[model samples]
Target: MPKRDRSKRTDPTAVMVRIVVADDGTLTVSVDGAPYLPPEFSPPWRRASFPAIVDAISQQTGRTLRVDVIETDGRTITDFYTPRTPRKAEPQTSAAESSVQAASAAEPAPAPRLMQFAGSGMIPGEEVAVAIIIAHAESGPDGIARTLIDSRYLEHSPTGEAVLLGRISATVCVGQPQ
Candidate 1:
C-alpha cells in the first residue's frame, strides 16, 4: 500500500477572520488564524477587540452591520453579523399590542434587544458630515409627540415632517433647550 501525503490542502472557501462568543459571554476574535486577543486576557481586553475588528470588516465589506449573537448548548457563535438597514417607526401601536408584547416576555430564547442611538451636540473635534438614521418615538396620550436626539451630534431637526425612513416620521422641535 502507498503511504498518503502528509501535507494538508487548504480550503478555498474558508474565512480567515472569525468572531466567537463563548457560553460565558466571552468574546474572542481571531485574525488570519491568530488570536487577536489571547485567552488569558480579561473580559475587557476581549471586548476591546470588537471595535478594531468591526472597523476592519466595515472597511472591507463597505457596509454597516449589526452583530446578532447566538448562544447554543455550550458555545456562543456571533455568526449572524449581517448588513442591516435601520428600522423605521410605526405610526402607532395599540395599547393591546403593547400588552401582548409584555405577555410574551418569558422564553428560553428571547428576542434580541434592539437599541437606537442618536444625538446632536457640538464638539471641538474635526467637523465631518454624518448621515444619521433616527426612529421617532410614539406620542403620549397627551397628544404631544417628542423626539429624542443627542445634542452632541445635533446638526438640526428636519424643517418639516415626512417619512424619515420607511413609515417613521420626523418630529421637529424649534429652539431646543441647552
Candidate 2:
C-alpha cells in the first residue's frame, strides 16, 4: 500500500462575490456564481447600501475575499477585501505639536485631466460599438475611485474610407496620501 503525504498545509480559498447595482439602488449578490441570501435577520439586503453589503461580507468571511461590483452605468469595479486590523493607540501629543504637524502636512495633489482618442478605418456611414475602460487600485485607506467607462456607437465618415473617431476625457488622481 502506498502511503500518502500527511503534512501538507492548505489554505482556504477566498470567496468570490459579485454584485450588480440597479438604477433604483437595488443590489443583487452572488457567491461563487450562486445566489446568496443572508439569514432572515438580514432581510432587505437587496436594497441595502453598497458599504453595508461590503461590511457584511467582510464580517461574514473573516478572511480575504474578492468582490466585483457592477454599476448601473455598465462599469464593473473590482476590489479585494481583508479583515481590518485593530487600530493602534496614538501617542500623547500636545495641542501645539498636533496643530504644527497638521499645518506641515502636504496637500494632496490635484488630479490630472487627460484625453484619449481612437480611430479605425471603416466603410462610410458604418456604425460600430466603442468602449473605453479605465481602472486603478491602491493599498490605502482612501481607496481609488470608481472606474471610468465610456461605451457608445461610432459612425464612419460619410464620404470615403475615412476613419471613425472617438474621444474620451478623464481625470486621473495619483500619489494620494495614505
Candidate 3:
C-alpha cells in the first residue's frame, strides 16, 4: 500500500473570521475572504444570533480565533476573541432534589419572547445602534402590521465591558383587518 501524503492541509489555528453588520442589521459572514454560512442556517443572520454563531465557529475550529465586526459605516463596532473552551455548564442537581425543587417552584411558563442583542468584550461606553424587530396591531409602510424598533441606540456598560439593550414586549395582531 502506498503511504498517503499529508503536507497539503491548512492550519486551523490561523483561521480568521469577519462579520459585517449591514445598515439593516443583517449579518454577512466571511472566512478568509470567502463567504461562510453557519452549519444549517441560510444567509442574512440577524444581530440576535451573533453570539451563538461565533461560539459555534469557535468550538468547531478548536482554537482561539479572532472575530471582527464592522458596521456599514466602515467602523469596527466590536472585537471578539472566541476561545476554544467549552461553554460553562450549569451545575447538576440530583433527581430527587430537582423534583422537589420543581414541585415547590412550578409556575406557568411565559410566552416565548425575543430580547435585544447583547455583546461582551466591547469597549466600555461605546455607543451601538440596535435594530429590534417587533410586531404591531396597525399596518405600517411595510404592509403587514409591524412594530419595528429600528435606529435604537445602546451604550456599552460602563463597568462591565459589555453592551446590552432594554427589553421590549408587545402583542402583534397580523392579518387582522383594521
For all predictions, the C-alpha RMSD in Å is 21.4, 14.6, 13.2
Stretches of model 2 off by over 4 angstroms after superposition: 1-12, 38-43, 46-48, 86-178
lDDT tens digits by residue: candidate 1, 31-77 = 55566564365453233245456666556554444443232243333
Query: lDDT of model 2 at residue 114?
Result: 34
lDDT of 1 at 101: 76
TM-score leader? 3
Which digits, one per residue and each the tens of the lDDT, describe model 3 over residues 42-90? 5567655566677777777765567777766686644546466457998
Indicate whether candidate 1 or candidate 2 has the larger TM-score: 2
Candidate 1 backbone collisions, by pair = 119-150, 120-150, 120-151, 120-152, 120-153, 120-154, 121-151, 121-152, 121-153, 121-154
Q: Rank order by lDDT, top first?
A: 3, 2, 1
State residue 126's C-alpha deviation in candidate 1, in Å: 27
Error of 3 at 166 (Å): 10
The estimated TM-scores of all candidates read 0.28, 0.39, 0.44
Q: Model 1, stretches more than 4 Å misplaced?
A: 1-15, 38-48, 55-152, 159-178
Tens digit of lDDT per residue, candidate 2, span 30-72?
Answer: 8779887666786544432445566777787776778887766
Lowest-lDDT window of 10 residues in candidate 2? 160-169
